[model samples]
Target: MHIWDVTNGARFSTYAIRADEGSGIISLNGGAARHVQVGDLIIVAAFASMSEAEAETFKPNLVYVDGSNTITHTNHSIPTQAA
Candidate 1:
């Protein structure tokens, strides 16, 4: 299990899992976790059930690619809130 304090302007945490051919997709549990938005920079704290090869290829900060794609990395950084 991975623990991340994403309150520092970061957004969602993405995980790439290798599953069955027909079950290769991302799933997000939206109960208390915040949903990631487009052009948001994210920081990865921990990764489980993922290989080193896949982890290296995966970007830390991910921007929304499209309606179909939820995780994508952006050149811009996530904005910080004022105290």
Candidate 2:
């Protein structure tokens, strides 16, 4: 997975997820955690390579959460951005 630090304009940094005793914790460790401050806006994105045909048929499951990190909803598509 790649973590993009949106607040600091940093490029993606590779990372491995570790299972924590306290579930539902989103944290950055090691060198990547050096520059990130608490409450920074970061995006964790994952990707998989597949054939073009497979890609066209792929629909990612998007999950939505509330401020408390509770899942509010989920769907396969996101609404279009307003013009």
Candidate 3:
């Protein structure tokens, strides 16, 4: 997974997912905090791998979230791989 910082346009690749939360909110820790700060806007993306045949037929789900990280809308689209 990768976390993209909205402020300075920084990208942090992380594998750790924190389970603890405060005020019913999940917070970033470790290396994620070094690139991300409090009240900073960020986009977290996770990817799944499949067989080549599955990839040819697989459709990815795109989630549109609001400022508070609430899912406002979603749609399915084919995944694109960069060269």
Candidate 4:
């Protein structure tokens, strides 16, 4: 998973999601956590690769989430809010 802090414009590629959900909590154990905090809106994206040009042009699946990190929406296209 790719973890990005939208609030601070910081990106991390090695965040470990150590726990499954129940309490709607997100934890980061190392120095990366310093870039984020409570109430920060972030993007957690899962991705795949394609070798074909047509396949490469296609958008990846995205799960738009909120402050609590709960997914609020999903789509094949990147959301306009990202820009």
Candidate 5:
């Protein structure tokens, strides 16, 4: 998984997930913690490589959350960005 700091044009970094269910925590550990500050918005994405057959049937899970990190909705596809 990679964490993208969407609010400040910060660089994205790969990270492993930790269990903190319901804690609403999304932290950048170690030295990477400096890359973010409280209240900064971020996008967390996970990617996987699969074969042609698997790709044909795959749909990425997209989770939507509120400011508190509580999931409000979820779907497999994202809407196209508007101008």
Candidate 6:
């Protein structure tokens, strides 16, 4: 997927966005510091347009593309309630 860098005003191929050690912080592509945090989600299109959305429902720590061009969301789990 295409990732637009709002800071640098550039676009790149989004490899992944993983959470840092602490909660509510994510690392992007091994390039810079954690750019996105909890409650933040970015939508990237093929033509290099990025739209930001609030991750109120669920926040995915990591997003990557596989060999089949399918985007994968991992490293995040649903909150469990006390039984």
- In model 4, the clashing pairs are none
Stretches of candidate 4 above 4 Å error? Answer: 21-23, 53-59, 80-83
Candidate 5 per-residue lDDT, tens place, 1-83, comes to: 77788888677666776867788777778877888888988888788889999999898899999998999999987678899
Which window of 10 residues has the lowest lDDT sum in candidate 4?
14-23
The lDDT for every candidate, in the order shown, is 0.46, 0.73, 0.74, 0.73, 0.83, 0.48
Error of 5 at 46 (Å): 1.0
**Candidate 1 residue 45 C-alpha distance from true site, Å:** 6.8
Candidate 1, residues 35-74: lDDT per residue as tens digits? 5443333344443467879866765553444334444446
Error of 1 at 20 (Å): 11
RMSD of each: 9.3, 2.5, 4.5, 3.6, 1.6, 13.8
Tens-place lDDT digits, model 6, residues 8-64: 555556565555443533346455324543333444543333345544555545545
Tens-digit per-residue lDDT, 1-83, candidate 4: 67888888989876556676645677766887787887777777666666798686887777666656667888887547654
Q: Could you tell me which 10 consecutive residues in candidate 5 have the lowest summed lDDT?
A: 11-20
Candidates by TM-score, descending order: 5, 2, 3, 4, 6, 1
- Itemize residue pairs with steric clashes in candidate 6: none
- TM-scores, all candidates, are 0.26, 0.71, 0.71, 0.60, 0.86, 0.28
Residue-level lDDT for 4 in candidate 3: 89
* Candidate 6 wrongly placed segments (more than 4 Å): 20-22, 30-83
Task: State which candidate has the highest TM-score.
Answer: 5
Better of 5 and 6 by lDDT: 5
Off by over 4 Å in 3: 16-26, 78-83
Q: Write the per-residue lDDT of candidate 3 for residues 1-83, one digit (tens) a residue.
A: 88888888999788855654432344677767788777777777788888999988887788776656666888897467999
